[model samples]
Target: MGIFDKIKEKLSHEFIDIIEWLDYTDDTICHRFERYQNEIKNNAKLIVREGQTAVFINEGQLADVFKPGTYTLSTQNLPILTTLKGWKYGFDSPFKAEVYFVNTHLFTDEKWGTKNPITLNDERFGLVEIRAFGSYAFKINDAGKFIVDIVGTDNNFTNFEINEHLKSLIATRFTDTVGEAKLPIELYAANTTELSETCKEVMQPEFNSVGISLEKFFIENVSMPEDLKKEIFEYSRLDKIDLDKLTKFKTAKAIEAAATNEGGTAGAGMGMGMGFVLAQQMGGMMAPQMGGQQQAPMQQVNTMPPPMPQAIQYFYSANGQQAGPVAFEQLKALFANRTVNKDSLIWKQGMTNWSPLLEVEELKAFLGGNTPPPLPGS
Candidate 1:
């Protein structure tokens, strides 16, 4: 080939070849050339340092020369500059991107500073304090598209703008999830953990749209109205009150039963005493009629004028002195006339011996008017 043609071919082959020759030196030149070629082939990578902000380009403008290392704007030719000034940096690998977070909002409160804003409070229905809010982190998966479709040649995009948009999106999704829950105020107030978990559950799908994965969401505190709190306390104590009332009822019933039994015993004793007194009076009144019948019989049956005109009788028997037949009428008369105290009669077992009973008054009251007559000659 002609020198001119060869020179032209070398220069015109591929931009990569020209760059390779330009960087070549010695044995290391080949290694350097290979490394550069590989870097170009895979598209140049950059590094976003820790605690630094970065701009992404979608125009593939950085596909050739970008290197994977922390960089700052030391030279004017630096391809991009972030709006955050020194805050901007880049990462070559998704792993390196993880070292720095993009600080995008996974969710935002449209009701930002309103009375009832979209916060832990909104989900839990109480005064909740948010310590650390939810945010997202992402890396440019497609460097070419990141450069071309996103920030283009200029690195002038504001993280605030991206964060705000993301915040709005998160807020919108969060609102929808919360609205659909329809949780009761009381239950929501009590279960802050559950509320946070529920928010995370609902936000997962929406967060995916912005190339972020939600790490976690948590509720710190919950507050409710004073009246509501008091009501809850009262309700919890209700069972104890009911138990106390039941105990009192049982005690009252036992007392009432004891009183009733005691009264009945007293009344029964009084009635017995009154019955005895009435029996004694009736017996005394009938005594005289019985005496009259006995006297008449004696008047009829006594052959000899009443032996001694007596309330007495003589005894004559073949073996010994025996009481002559006491006129039945006289005996009957004695008993009926109350001449004899019926209550005083007592009989012995073997001999029909008669004796006076002790406690005669008690006996007479217990026996009615028809009590048997005392034995003769006693």
Candidate 2:
């Protein structure tokens, strides 16, 4: 072969004729077509497979974008690139331009989580901190815009790079949406589906700004502090508790304790008091049940002679001296004569200390009926 023939063969070999990409790594979002200083020959065949898009950048400006299809690089098909290159007429020589293949398939299982707890104001819980995490899916929508805005000069861009940015964006938008939602803290877990949809809607515009499409968003779990969780759980049981029954249960327990400690004087006294109170309660409870039996009134009447009455004596403080123990009738006469008044200290058998006459239940009867004036000083 002649020298000219050899040079033509070398020049032909130096130009790229077929421009395509076979993506092996599923994580790759964009891969630059490696030409190694070789220019693309005129009428070069551009192969854009399914789930992929071809973007051409000329002179640092996004020029032509091709969807999944076979394309021949020409003035007709490369209108934007041709115009940017000022090629009024299509050229026959090789052209130098950047070709990038962007993955248009959904990139799923991208994780997003709040690194710090999101503070939210809840009506029942007040200010609460919660953390959330879940997976999301996305895809490149506008290849040209994506190349221009995010993947600039990135020869091989993987989802890892973009995921970090997307996760931060998702976290921010998630916090904002959750806070604005104002849902009860306890409902966050139960309503994750609704919250996820709302978060997707809120973050779609952010993704769109950079030519990405948020295909799916999810909130797998929302969690609060363990203590807060326990508190919420306990609060939920409040309506289930029967306070009256609980009080009775506590009283029964106290009585049991008093009965077990018969050795101590204090315990004995407590046992006696508890027994009296318990008897009164039992009597009150039985009254209704007995009355409901429809028994005739005569059946409840006593058939035996009544027991003799025991008189209760009283004592009074007269002129700073302890007076004799007077009968109840005599005590009433003393009160009527103004020898003792409601304020006069009095005591009775089994009484712990002297009490004001007005404070005594049995003596209160003396103050009723006709009013009597105080006697003149003798």
> Which residue pairs collide in model 2, if any?
none
Q: Tell me model 1's lDDT, rounded to 2 decimals.
A: 0.39
Q: What are the lDDT figures for the candidates, one per model? A: 0.39, 0.85
- Show model 1 residue runs off by greater than 4 Å: 1-163, 243-378
Worst 10 residues of 1 by lDDT: 23-32
Query: Candidate 2: lDDT over CA atoms?
Result: 0.85
- Model 2 residue runs over 4 Å out of place are 1-9, 245-378
Candidate closest to the true structure, highest lDDT: 2
Distance from true location, Cα of 149 in model 2, Å = 0.4
Native RMSD of candidate 2 (Å): 13.1
Every candidate's CA RMSD? 32.7, 13.1
